[model samples]
Target: MNYKTTKILWKTFVWIVLIIGTIITLVPLFWMLSTALKSNAEVMQFDMVWWPEDPKWSNFVEAFTTLPFGEWTMNTIFITVFTIIGTLLSCTVVAYGFARFNVRGNKTLFIILLSTMMLPSTVTMIPQFVIFRELDWINTFYPLIVPSFFGNATFIFLLRQFFMTIPTELEDAAKMDGLGTMGILGRIILPMTLPALTTVAIFQFNGAWNDFMGPLIYLSDPDDFTLALGINFFKGENNQVQWNYLMSASVISMLPSLLIFFFGQKYFIQGINLSSGIKG
Candidate 1:
């Protein structure tokens, strides 16, 4: 084949693959939305229904108003916001130290930190529960929010990678201008690392927003339940599962994450690339 013809064929193949992948990914989401607008009768049928004959737009209103979804949503937002703040603050400071400061055993410590990521959370779950129980943190936001203030190994690693990419000359100039460590980090380092920080925040936000296990374990009060937990209860409240309402609630719960990801996609991709090895 001619070179130009071969290149065109390759591009066509890639586009075909991407289109197929997109359809596969979107199918489940489309199904979920389709089911949300369906009736129980339609949902139970052996024959698959791609779309409902009469779409129940009211399912969203009913699902949202039937439970304390508003309260749960607020609770989720509070936890997610706090979690992002704690993660950013703690991870930034820790990453800055590892990236900028020359300290004895810094490399060793960083390796040790990275190693902790390999340790499964299942291994520490019991110990963490016991500690939190001892502190009387159960059924409290403390259990959910407090841990994020301690640096997450994955986020620290990403931030540290991005931090190392920055030129040291900026720090040198800041020092000459009498900017302290915090000042340099705030004014010079953070502005440049916006992509990475946004990536971290988005990760934390999605994790916190969708978190089920943590809230399930730590929060006992119904009023304090997050969306995930609340959805579980929503299913349990009915003897026969109302698939329509369940899917509707789920669709509602996922909207914030969907919106955030769609809006921040550019920054998120950029952050991942820069942290992977690209210099700032």
Candidate 2:
């Protein structure tokens, strides 16, 4: 019960907790991969099959071929690309304005905008559906892609905070060099904001890629379905759930998100830190 012994015991406890948490978090992912490699018989076994005896590597190939995974992936990519573009274009400008401009009612307007976030989407989902229905946007990408062109509250807030961290002296110097707002944004702000922009792009990409609700609501054509909806479709297409194929499809679907995060992790962490007011 000396100080050194107590500190060592505390560190041991913390490490044990962290190890347990890590295992808990990774178990589902491990299960999914294991199931993907299993046969239907192996998957349906009474005892838990942690790993398959005969790993069917062909499940990945069959997952794509059995379903229109390629086409669904293309549809998803198309939606995700446009969603990222729209979110970046709209959120950057709005955030920049909120961070830089001293227009009248600016604070009030921003507060109102932020307030919208507190209003659950379920409250407005019916109204939005009605409007989209009137516009004949059902079964089209418009309902899914076009909304991002406006702005996202959470992304706007993140970008706005990051933008505020930038020195106004830069803008002043740009103005002295005859750079107007757009010129300064393009020449000065953009290069410096790459981390934050990448963060936003990654967020939007993951969201649009995994979006099931939007595509389910707006899309009717099986061919136009996003990967998320396609996965659901694959689940329901068979009377008995083919857990192997479903798990294989899910594993394939998650690769892009995992890859993006793996590559962009440094920028993502930096952006989050900067936006949260931690300088450097």
Q: Could you say which candidate leads in lDDT? A: 1
Error of model 1, residue 45, in angstroms: 1.7
Report lDDT (CA) for all predictions.
0.94, 0.94
Global fold similarity of model 1 (TM-score): 0.97
Candidate 2 error regions (>4 Å): 1-4, 236-239
Quickly count the clashes in candidate 2. 0
After TM-score superposition, the amount by which residue 181's alpha carbon in candidate 2 deviates from its true location, in angstroms, is 0.6
Writing each residue's lDDT as its tens digit, candidate 2 over 1-280 gives 8999999999999999999999999999999999999998999999998999989999999989988989999999999999999999999999999999999999999999899999997898899999999998898999999999999999999999999999999999999999999999989998999999999999999999999889988899999998999987655544778889999999999999999999999999999999999866
C-alpha lDDT of residue 228 in model 1: 95
Candidate 1 residue lDDT tens string, 1-280: 8999999999999999999999999999999999999988899989999999999989999998999999999999999999999999999999999998899999999999999999998899999999999999999999899999999999999999999899999999999999999999999999999999999999999999999999999999999999999988656654778889999999999999999999999999999999999645
Candidate 1 has which clashing residue pairs, if any?
none
RMSD per candidate (Å) reads 1.4, 1.3
